[model samples]
Target: MHTFSRADFERFGQLYDIEFRFPAIHGDNSTDDYIVARGEITEHSLASGFRFTFSSLEVLEAYDSVSCGHAPLLVLVVLDGIVRLTLGSVEHELTPGTAVSMQLHPDYPLQAHQPEQQHLEIMALAFDPRRAKLGHVSPSLHGLTILPRMPLRQWKVPHALQQLLRTYAGLTMTGTQKNLVLEGVALQLAGLGLGSEEQESPDVPVVPVQQRQRLELVRQHLEFTPDHDHSLKDLAQMAAMSPSGLRAKFRAMYGVPVFDYLRKCRLQLAKHYLEQGFSVEQCANKVGYTHATNFSTAFRREFGFSPRQRTVDQKK
Candidate 1:
């Protein structure tokens, strides 16, 4: 077992990013801000790694597009702001109050976009399932319960779970205190994410290749027309799928229930509008919210802040 108190986040971001689409990252990652990505590794038997981080990169900027292909399964929780991720052909809008379990199982391409100059905070936990060759006589790899074996499953992170992650991220405790606290919290979070797997079972039939293609069409439609009036019947009719099948398969493939995904899209569009000088009312209308008050409440609940708090920030 090993503990790393201060870890380099941007450096690790490169371990995946630089290899794919990003050429370089530029921002003020001075000494103080540069090394807060922390983790603990227990490699005695099973090669297990857990990292819980709250990274705020001031003046953070990325040059070029993100083209991540085939990254392993991990639990990603967005605590603030929005992160747009394209996994395979299905694009997902990850906002606060949302969590997803996705695996980069060979050739599954992922492209992520967070508006430049918008600070984002997230907690990502990575664990390896492979066993170590020489450690504690090699046993108990399956005992690790936090690792997601099911691949691409997404669900909402409960408020209590969100609080736990935030507490761990902001902890001033160090040395053994940090390690003890982190391992417990990380495992707990993982277990919570795994609980979402009960939604899938032997009862639900697998989606066919052609229906999956139709679902892709539906995904593209939502992406392009985030504000359009969409109904489940209309969407299922368009996709040529039974309503029930469409609902189940959509959640299976995209990790979000249909209505939930729609809300994510609407709020994400609202984020763009608010950040672009639109008044709360105007933005609310643009995203199809009937009232500004309702929109504000939803936005606050989603991203941890009110729309009034965001300025029409131009890149400085």
Candidate 2:
């Protein structure tokens, strides 16, 4: 296993952004944004032409948008925490137990939101679609189209598959045995994540390009400044739509109600604060909650544990 800390990951990001361009250019080309403030990412690459990464890290800061490099195809499984991403014009949220199989285009790179303070554990498998010969392994990916706005598939990860990944991560093996095991895992992940040949893309409502761009502004506001007490009228004005139109279209496009998304962003940041040794009341106020009780209730509902409990657990 190859382990990379934040500094190492940042250096590689810089290199990939600035110098590397053999097979393809990867990593977001940014100067100021630090990817992670804590934790590490471990990777295992197989000779069978697949690379798998297990990343456990905390976001250094909140970003409304960050570009991800070109990959022909990628299967991402959210082991824990939430990841928000935009492909083409559609925004998606990946929670624990969820996985996505996406066919990415070079021109329209994937845009991501890294939530501040939130700890994330993500497992990603990436490969070149042209050379992967996935048809022989899984017939479903045979005719997968490579589009700028491709039809990606989202599904729940099986419990057994999750256990298998954890098991593989713990195993001590090398050489041919490791390669064989990795090949099998790769196939299984791809088969389950993107296995349905008949899986149809969800019907995303077609809004005008101008309206979509404005809607994105609203989303960015909610994501980046979740602590603000945003009003629907103001947000509607920002999106150049009626309040109801904004409400309906935002949900239609982003898969969640507008304010509901904001609540999630706030709670995610609050959780991060609690992990960093902040008091429950402090976290509640910081995330715009007037009452600590309300914040505690919401936090427990969202994360299945109280803020104080999170702090205690971390100490242990």
Best by lDDT: 2
Give the Å error, residue 313, model 2. Answer: 34
State each model's C-alpha RMSD to the native.
10.2, 10.8
Q: Model 2, poorest ten-residue lDDT window?
A: 17-26
Q: Provide the TM-score for each candidate, comma-separated.
A: 0.46, 0.50
Give one digit per residue, the lDDT tens place, for model 2 in 3-105.
3334554566573331211111125634333233467667777644467888777755454434355554678888878888766434678888888887554
Give the alpha carbon lDDT tens digit for every residue of 1-316 in model 1.
Answer: 1222113433444654523222343355433243222234221112245544454442244422353533334677887767777554345678887887665433344566655445456776654544223453214334343223343467898898888776654468876677677666666666666664345666657767677667866765675576788999988998898898789888886678877777877887788776667888898998888888998898999999888887434322
lDDT of 2: 0.69
lDDT of each: 0.61, 0.69
lDDT of 1 at 214: 78
lDDT of 2 at 223: 64
| Model 1 collision count | 2
